[model samples]
Target chain A: AGDAEAGKGKIGLCVACHGTDGKGIMPMYPNLNGQNATYLESALKAYRDGNRTGGTAPIMAPMAANLSDQDIADIAAYYSQL
Target chain B: AGDAEAGKGKIGLCVACHGTDGKGIMPMYPNLNGQNATYLESALKAYRDGNRTGGTAPIMAPMAANLSDQDIADIAAYYSQL
Candidate 1:
């Protein structure tokens, strides 16, 4: 199942923009709180695969470049609950 | 002071993905609640200027492209408090 606490541990870089609350820093960075894990997983996968291009994609593509599928799940899970 | 009320009015489009509470829909869209106004403002400006590019930037760029500085500010102000 989605583990919010586990995801929180993995969000080091994510917190830089998205913020600790998952509320996002604003403007470009989006809010992560209460988003569906499915959408989060898909977007992260797209960023990792280079299918999606937009603001911070380059950065996220690289950041997500090494993430395992499970990691994506965990991160998505954590933010979704927020 | 930041007008959360006024910002809420302009956040109609934002709420589509971000949700009414500023919590993002998940994985892709970010949470908007409790983010810093300055950070939100900067991010929005980046989207407007095409400086930051990533997952949703294309849609956001065009979405934000038409916004004036004050609009950006207002939106930022709105989301930061949420």
Candidate 2:
């Protein structure tokens, strides 16, 4: 997947909760750094589609709503490298 | 949180993708068996709220749409134990 500088900006909201390192700030946040890219991609889609549910739903549903398939792939690539 | 047998039924959808053990069979699925509870909870919410995005969005968005806060918490507890 190609790196999108635009996607990096989109990830800011994620950094706020997951941290720049993807280690996550609170117990409520997950460590996204080094997570499997394919897995992360599925998770993002699941959140968008509503297959998963939890405390972060309110925050995730909207974030995922607008993502294109390519955007999802790109983000997944970024997180996988972190 | 109290163990909800009912919640267990709801998690079946997750099992299909995450596997009964949470190890995840596909590259697209994440291992949920041992994720941190608080982190998992927040993630679920992020999906529900549309803050996260990815390949599994279509499936996840609708799944989380109807979940109650308690249901989310109970499921998080179960996944944490797995």
Leading candidate by TM-score? 1
lDDT of 1 by residue, B2-79 (tens): 466777778766887777677766545666666667656766777788764556777777778878777777887887
Query: Which portions of model 1 miss their true places by more than 4 Å?
Result: A1-35, A38-63, B23-28, B51-54
Q: Where is model 1 chain B poorest over a 10-residue stretch in terms of lDDT? A: B26-35
Q: Candidate 2 at B41: error in angstroms?
A: 1.6
Compose the digit string of candidate 2's lDDT tens values, residues A1-82.
5264545656865777776667767776676765667787777777778755556666777888888777877777777676
TM-score of chain B of each: 0.87, 0.81
Every model: Cα RMSD to truth: 4.7, 6.0
What candidate 2 keeps of the native contacts, as a fraction, is 0.62
TM-score of chain A of each: 0.90, 0.82
Which is the leading candidate under lDDT? 1
Each model's DockQ score: 0.19, 0.32
